[model samples]
Target: MLYQIISFVLEVATSLFGGACLLRLYMQHQRVPFGNPVGRFVFALTDGLVLHLRRVVPSTGRWDMASLVGAYLLKLTQFGLLWLLAGGLAAVGWVPLLAVFGLVQMAISGLTGLLIVYAILSWTQAGSPLSAVIDRLCAPFLAPFRRILPLVGGIDLSPLVLLVVLQVAAMVLASLQQSMLR
Candidate 1:
């Protein structure tokens, strides 16, 4: 019970901040302006760590290395703490490997969430700023699928397809993690 509670708290905290770092990285990659609410929220959550890490992790060609490293560090911390709590019985060396998998899983989950929000906003609030931001973010991910799938009866199905792909990726990730651990 105590372990569960601690794990839950750490997961929530890591997701909130680590996910923000990842979002910041993506937003920068997409050349999205940070003046909007989503950007502001991401900055608020991640600025401290990302800014400090920037000294050590330099950005290269549209990729914000600091933000990526920040997210990875958060995952490392989360897994490291959990490993300690788990009585250090398992393969301790796998903590870093698990952290990498967790970071990828988190990115997959975040994209999945953004797709859902994009769909919802498309249906109910098409022209809002938030909707526009989400649309821009989703566009790159959806473009290939949209090109191949096309619209059905004037409704986009790419997000559904992308969601399925992400699920499969998650499953693959889990299997890979297990294999690597073993």
Candidate 2:
């Protein structure tokens, strides 16, 4: 019970900040301006860790490596604490692997979420600034699918296809993690 509670709390905290870090990286990669509400929120949530990491982890091309590292660090801390709570010292060596798995899972989950919001906004609030921001973010992920799948009855199906792809990726990642742990 205690472990569950701590794990839940840590997962929430890690997901919030770690998701922000990932969002920051994607926003920068998309060359989206960090002046809107979502951008401000992400910057507020991640600036401390990201700025500190920026000193050591320089950007590669347009990618914000520092934000990516920050997200990984956040996942590492979460898995490390959970390992400690479980008193699994014998398997402590797997903590880093678990962290990597967790980070990938988080990325999958985050992209899933972003796509959901983008789809919703497209249907209901297509002209808002936030919608534009989301459209830009979703474009790269959806482009290949869009190229292959034309609009069905004038409605874009790229989000649905992308969501399905992400789910499959998540399942495959889970299997890999389980096998690696074994």
Candidate 3:
């Protein structure tokens, strides 16, 4: 029970911080303006780690490599700590692979979350300021799917399709993570 609780808290904290880093990277790639509420919130949440990393990890073209590295580092730390807590020092060699697996899981989960919020906001508050930011963030990911999948009765099903695809990706990631345990 104690281990489970600790694991839960660690997961939540790492996911939020790491997710923020991934979001910052994506936003930068999309050339998203940081003046909006979503941008400000993400900046505030991730600035401390990201700013420090920026000193060492310079951007490549439009990509914010610092943010990506920061997120991966967070996952690595989280898994390393968890391994220590579980008294599994012998398996330390697998930390890097686990961290890489964690990063991919985080990315899929984060996109699924953003798409959910975007879908809800599109229905509830179509003209809200926040909606525009969500749309922009989601547009690049959803574009190819949108072109491939036809809308049904004026309702865009791209998000739903994307969500399903992400879930499948998450399942595959889970299998990879489990394989590392053996």
Model 1 weakest 10-residue run by lDDT:
89-98
What digit string (tens of lDDT, one per residue) describes model 3 on residues 1-182? 98889889989999999999999999999999999998998999999999999999999999999999999999999889889989989979988888999999999999999999999999999999899999999998899999999989999999999999999999988987798687
List model 2 lDDT by residue over 95-178, tens digit each.
888888999999999999999999999989999999999999999989999999998899999999999999999999999998
Which residue pairs of candidate 3 clash?
A: none
lDDT of 1: 0.95
Backbone clash numbers for all candidates listed: 0, 0, 0
C-alpha lDDT score of every prediction, in listed order? 0.95, 0.94, 0.93
Over the stretch 60-164, how does candidate 1's per-residue lDDT look in tens digits?
999999999999999999999999999985678888888999999999999999999999999999999999999999999999999999789999999999999
What order do you get sorting by lDDT, best first?
1, 2, 3
**Candidate 1 TM-score to native:** 0.97
Question: Which residue segments of model 3 deviate by more than 4 Å?
Answer: none
User: What is the C-alpha local distance difference test score of candidate 2?
Assistant: 0.94
Could you list the CA RMSD of all candidates, in the order they appear? 1.1, 0.8, 1.0
Maximum-lDDT candidate: 1
